[model samples]
Target: MTDIATKPDSIIAVERWNTFWGARDLEGMKTVAADDFIQWHATVRKNLTKDEEFDMLVEALKVMQITFKNICLTPMNNDTVLQQCVADIAIEGAGTRNDVPFAMVFHTRGQKITKCEEYMDGMSLPPIEFTPQD
Candidate 1:
C-alpha cells in the first residue's frame, strides 16, 4: 500500500471504501458513497444503486469475510481511478478462497464515490443461498 498522505483524494476515497468493507462498517460505506452512486457489475451484468449495493453487501457479510491483497491502483484522470486486487473471501461452512481476481473502475467527486464499474470471476465466488426476507 502506498503512503496515504501521498495519495490522491480519489485513491483515498477508494481506500476508505475498501477499508469500510473489511471493517463491516456500513455507515462508513455510506459516508464515502455519493447519493447517486451506482455500481455496474460486468460479470453479473447488473447495475446496482447505492442502496441496492449496500443491501447486497449487508447480506453477503452475514456469511463471509472478505480481504484484499496485491492491490494496484491507476489514476485514470483527476476524478477516475482503476483498481485491481486479489480478493480473499472466506465463507462460513465453505472454506476460504484466495487470490480471486477482482477489478473496479471508480469515479469520484469531492471524496465521494459517484460510480463504480466492477469486474470479477463469477466462478470464483462460492455459492451462498440467501433466503428472502418476509
Candidate 2:
C-alpha cells in the first residue's frame, strides 16, 4: 500500500477507495469520504449516498466478495482521478466470476472523496442472494 501522507489528496482518496474494496475495509472507506459523498451508477440510472453505499456493502458482503486486479489510476487533475480495474466477484452460491471490467472517476476535495461516477456491465455481475435493507 502506498503511504497516504506522501501522496496528494486525490491520490490518497483513490488509494483508500481501492483499499476499501480490495481489502473489504469498510472502516477505511469512511475515512476518505466526504460527508456528502455520492456515487452514481450511470448505466443503471442509480445513485447512492455514502451511507447508503456503505449499508449496501454490508449486505452485499454477506453473499459476495470483490477483489480488484490490473488496477490503473490516472490523475485527471489535482482533484479528480480515473480508475480502471478488473473485478473478481465471488458469490457465495453463484461461483466466482473474474475479469469483470469496472471503471470510475473519483472526485476529491482535500483528503476526502466527494463523489464517484462508476461504469460497469451490470449484467456481468453474478447474482447474489441478498436483499438490501430498507
Candidate 3:
C-alpha cells in the first residue's frame, strides 16, 4: 500500500478509492470523498453522487465476485489520477459470469475525491442512454 502523505494528492486519492472498494467499506469511502463528490459510470446513464455510488456498489457486491488487478495508476497532474485495471467479475445474474476491463479518472481536492469517471466493459440491462447534465 502506498502512503498518502508520501505520494502526490492524486495518487493518495486513487489509493483511498481502491482501498475502500477492495474492502467494500462504504463508510471508509465517505471519509475520503468530498461532500459534493460525484461519479459517472460508463454502464450507468446518470451521474451518481457519493452516497448513490456507495449504494450502487452495495448492490453490485452482492451479486458479483469483483476483484481489481494489474492496476496502473498515473498522476496526470497534481489533482488528477488515471488508472486502468482488469476487473475479474463473476456476475451471478440468470447464471452468467464474465471478466471485464475497467478504467477511471479521479480528481481530488486536498485529501478527498471530488469526482471520478469510470469506464467498464459490460452491458447494463434495459440499455441506458447517457445524458450529461453537468
Candidate 4:
C-alpha cells in the first residue's frame, strides 16, 4: 500500500472501497483496507476495527448482499477525504436503499484505508441472496 495521506492515493482508496464493496469479494476487500482499519457507522456509536470489521464483513456477506449503482465521489479535500455520491442500491429484501447517501471520511497514510468512518441508515437489511433455487 502506498501512503494515502497523500493525494490521488486517498482518492484511489475511495474508488477501491466502492469496487470491493460492490463485489463483496473478501480477499479483494482486504487488499485495499489497512490491517487495522476502523469503521464507525454514524448512526451507531459502536466502533469496529481490524479483525472485527473483517469478521463482520465476512459473516455479513454470508447472508448479506447488495449491489452498488451510480457510485460517484466528491472530494472533501485534496488529501484528507471525500464524500460518496448519492446512490440507489438494490437490496434484495429491504427494498431499494434509494437515494441513500453516505459520507466517508478517510484517515490514510498510504494507498490503504488506515481508518474510515461511514455514515448510513440503520434500517434493517433484508435477507441477502434470497435467490430462489429452481
Residues 51-111 of candidate 2 have per-residue lDDT tens digits of: 8878877988888877888999888875899999988878887888889899999999987
Quality of model 2 by C-alpha lDDT: 0.81
Q: Could you tell me the lDDT of residue 54 within candidate 2?
A: 86
Q: What is candidate 1's lDDT per residue for 1-134, written digit by digit as tens?
A: 67877778898999899888778899999999999999887655678889888887788789888788888989888689999999888889988988899899999997899999988886766665542232
Clash total of candidate 1: 0
For 1-134, candidate 4 gives per-residue lDDT tens digits of 44655548777876787777777777887887888787775545567876777877676556545555556555555355756655555543456656666667776656787877777665544434322212
Which residue pairs collide in model 4, if any?
A: 2-110, 2-111, 3-109, 3-110, 4-109, 4-110
Per-residue lDDT tens digits for candidate 3, residues 64-98, read 66678999998887598889987766656434334
Where does model 4 exceed 4 Å of error? 1-7, 87-96, 123-134
**Candidate that beats the other on TM-score, 2 or 4, i.e. the better one:** 2
Cα lDDT listed for each candidate: 0.85, 0.81, 0.76, 0.65
TM value for model 1 = 0.85
In terms of lDDT, the best-performing candidate is 1
Off by over 4 Å in 1: 1-6, 129-134
TM for every model, in the order presented, reads 0.85, 0.85, 0.81, 0.70
